[model samples]
Target: MSVPSQVDLASCADEPIHIPGSIQPHGFLLFLDAAGRIEGWSANAPEILAGQLQLGLAYTTLPLPPACTDLIAECIDLLAEGEYAPAVAAVSIAGHDYDAIVHGSHGRVIAEFESRDVPADTVAMFAVKAHSSIERVRRQRSIEGLLETAVRQVREFTGFDRVMAYVFREDDSGDVVAEARRDDLAPYLGQRYPAGDIPAQARRLYVLNTLRMIADIGYTPVPLLGAPGAAPLDMSFGVLRSVSPIHVEYLQNMGVHASMSVSIVINGRLWGLIACHHMAPKRVPHAIRMAADVLAQVMASTVQSIEARSDAELVEQSAKVRTALVESLLIDEEPLDALARHADDLLAATRSQALVSVHNGKIISHGPIERETAEAIVRAMPADASDILVRDKLGEWPQDVHASVGKWVGLLGLPFDPPGGGWCLLLRTEQIEHVSWGGRPEKLAQVGPLGERLTPRGSFDAWHETVRGHAHPWEATVLANARLTQSELLRASNARRAQLDSTRAQLLAMLGHDLRDPLHSINMAGTLLERGAVQPTLGRRIQSSSNRMQRLIGQVLDMSRIDGGMGLGMVFEPLDLAALVEDVIDESRMAYPSIDYSFANPGPTCVRADGGRLGQVLSNLLSNARHHGEVGRPIVATLAREPGWAVLEVANGGAPIAQDVAASLFNPFKRSSLHNPRNRTGMGLGLYIVAQIVREHQGEIAYRHEHGQVVFTVRLPLAEMERAGPT
Candidate 1:
């Protein structure tokens, strides 16, 4: 990620705020000595601080009114550890209520007391309303509907004129996807805002505060005072903490007179914001903000689930298409011809408009492509272009190629020829977009009384900008497809090359290593179960991983049977690939939570194959993704179906697989590290087992490297086995 510009970055972090010598007028502050005597107090301390007496008086003797003394004393139990938490309690004295914040700093106990006249009946009312709202939000099945309900519930609870669900993008910029507003207000839905609008320091504050409010944008900030040479106080935990000036200006420019915000945080990061705006100055009760916090928890969990789901879908789609392409290549003796036969499916699987296969200095074009353009693409290809090369914009092409700007704006290059001579290029045409921003994105310089200074935009009118010279950047689904196809074609080429100089002793050398890891685990689990020390999750892992191992062994044995001129021991039955995909993702959640997954199931993709063998294929593919893919980013899996075939793909982002390794990807003993990266187990028969299974099933499996990810795919034919079909 690149650093955002400092000009637009607004943070008042360095100002001496602890000794600001003032406090928000709505609150009274007191500093206590070691013996609990009042040392210093805010100027208005006399009016609401219990009409207490002068200096050196014990603060404990000032108020004993409604059992708040015990709560205050309990707060100080951990004061030695510097626990200065806010929002301790709501204590009522003489028919009025005040919120208390008692904290310890520098061996001195400081107390802040504020009153919004917090109604006595508000808690009971809010509890009932929150319970019903939570039940309704929990009923939503899709993430879109869930978060939409969250913002609506908050809007109703807070009585704000407008409320928007603002979710952050990959670049930290935000978009308003859901909104609730009065009819008189203009809608801010679907508008994009720049990153620095809330700055870095403010983002940190949000995580700490969880919820913040500005009663009136036009009100002056009340400064907290300290001694002349004292350090500033950290008000990060203060409920009435003032906001940054730039943010206030930003709100004013948007025609908002008052605002309140709830931090929708997920796993320690600020995922998004629930922003509430009022056209008039309005103070939201503190009790309502606390209720909003409850909804934030629901939104955070839902968002995490949605992100994981999207990743799983992408993985499913990539697996489907790449697997299909690889399977097609295995059937045809001439790969170029196979490419032509599967042209339509390949294009459909990837986010591309065309495919161009260049071999022996000759170009075979498909789907609205030209020979000259294909030749130029080959010349511009990278040196080691065996891995997939993706370019979203066609910059500085030759005059002839450049002439077709909108027609061919994006390109994906997959080299098939030994070095850089042959290539398969996927193309994407330009897509024009109209963008709306909350304000003009550019900064302005004004010659004010002070020297030339950069100022925030004065107006936040809807700014429209027409964007061009771009195409839909190849998504992980298509990139994974490309990588898987590249793998298969390269493996096939290597097998053909080996035919000229192959030998026998080294043929099955890799199988010399035993598949003992799963067997060992199964043995241990069985022993423990016999001894009555049963662990369900452990037993399940042993069962699942061992079953996959058995399928792999069966696939190999079946291949050996064919090689030895013996009959096969295999069963065929129709099964839904989508169901298998869901099972794999759910298992991965428990086993490999570090890797985010996207499983895309276009529909009910079914194939006639051995269910156990296919599960092995999926298990191995996901295992490979977890070990080989990038951390933090989603590993995409895809399942696609055609007239007679089902394709499954697994794609992950990381360093591109090198040409030498990709060439031997399907051969035994060519193992990559697992998730831990330190433990190197197994005979490396995973892909070899997968390839044999695909071949026996009369389908195909392939590999490729695209968009910095290694993608593997398995393809199988769908059979018309009836309900009574035997295996």
Candidate 2:
């Protein structure tokens, strides 16, 4: 027989081999087939797998047990596919559905070993050992699962009466989501701890030390190293490790005598804590604690996993519901009905009792509570406050009603995106016995004196001692989800409102500017005519003003049509470029009689463009130069042909445009601060319209400044002009 390679044997050695001197004396050696069936087993397997017989028997060829055959088959399939090749599979053995390490090779099970078992008091310690290898393998799995597993392992390994995974809330509160403890202790799986209980200082210390231990609350304190005698031991803990004395006192007050805490660091910042609490005084050896710390690190990833998965599920569900609501509103135009229909589902999904309220400064409709009662509650709320919770006055309510309603207490006020329109209110009530407050009872007394006294009989009795009647007010996760939902809705509403307002503003500005220029010219002509200046020169000037007004009116019509998506029809006919330039010059001279105008055409050039629109573009550019550029400085218009296209250049001796202004010059309603006050006659749309018209003709326009002057140029494709025939 050939021997296996040393590397392969070494790899197997690194696998989950039985470690001697474990708390449990029994040892197990198991061999599984490619299908995870028991191909071979050692004599010691039965002794070690005592209570865990199901798992040991699973490896056998005998008919698989009905209880776990499917689970084993699934694991074997995963191993065969190499998905679990590098990782140990924590398979349950028979009745003992605990954790064990199973290794596989080449689609076949190679070896398996059960971790040492220990005393019930030390089961948590043994679990830690059992999970170390699996924990390491989990690092390569999902990060979120890694965190959840880490937390679960810590809780199960430390023998803490209760282990909680807590995360910080935006409101500085903390929530308990994942919890594990012995059967003797009450479950705190979904409890929420108040922010006041943790306090700012305690949280700061918890973050400083990622790992902390209160081995024995009653143990004597190790005095400070420097008591004016011996030098300090310089025993400062790791930044990820620190103990809070106040927290210890708080726990002691709660009857907890020992605790261990580790920080859950995400992206190098403290995300939350994994806290393990022991009800009775306990002492852990240094080695065991070190092992716990290592396991804690491994388990952090698992805790993160569970949180992420849970959050993803919540978000997905929320999205589905939100989509349904939004679609229903769009389709049926009945938002209230849609919300009502989903009330129970939303409440159960969010783990809160929700009340929907419609209000217009006064309550209109409410669900899950009487309208009169809701209004009274709303009226009693502080003016500036939108939400309030009263947990102390539960006994005041009518006894029959209170009994039916349960002892849960929570109040949430959701104002409409634009307040005073209509709003929503959600109230959650949990059974009263589950409520626990970490703060002093005296603090509860302080809020009791408010005139809102609770009646001691009937439904009102539940309102008495209100502080103690409610489950801890909104937890970090609940509040965060609520805020996220509200913010998204607010953002969408604001964005839509902004878009509508922008469109309205743009339309109004377009109308005012487009009509103002022609109106001004007509008014000017009428004023001049009323003065009785009938001289030949004055008559010609008045005629010119009327023509300019007519042209402006035509430009406005064309612009409106273009903006309305109406196509600009072009008449293709051979046209002289020189004539077009000359016409533009004459029109500009007439429009701005005070400015000098010049034209240059290099040769007899023929091109095709809509004569009216092309002339309007040229006239607008020249007019802009006369009004915005330096007046009295000659405006020069030039036309030339380059290889594939014709180019028209309008140059003016004017103040150079600043680089920033030049960038936005062609945008609608954009005017440089340097524009002349006397020429505020245009609505700043001349260049914008010019660019648009030119682009429609398959041409390009650009602006540049040189030698104390700014120049605008238009380039049109020569071939396109030929296809269009002419202007």
All models: lDDT?
Answer: 0.68, 0.53
lDDT of 2 by residue, 197-310 (tens): 554545555554466666566544322111122111111232111133344445665577877777766555557677788888654433344566556555556656766787
Which candidate ranks first by TM-score, i.e. highest? 1
Residue 177 error for model 1, in Å? 2.4
Residue 301 lDDT in candidate 2: 62
Give the Cα error of residue 229 in candidate 2, in Å: 13
Q: Residue 142 of model 2: what lDDT?
A: 59
Per-model TM-score on C-alpha atoms? 0.58, 0.34
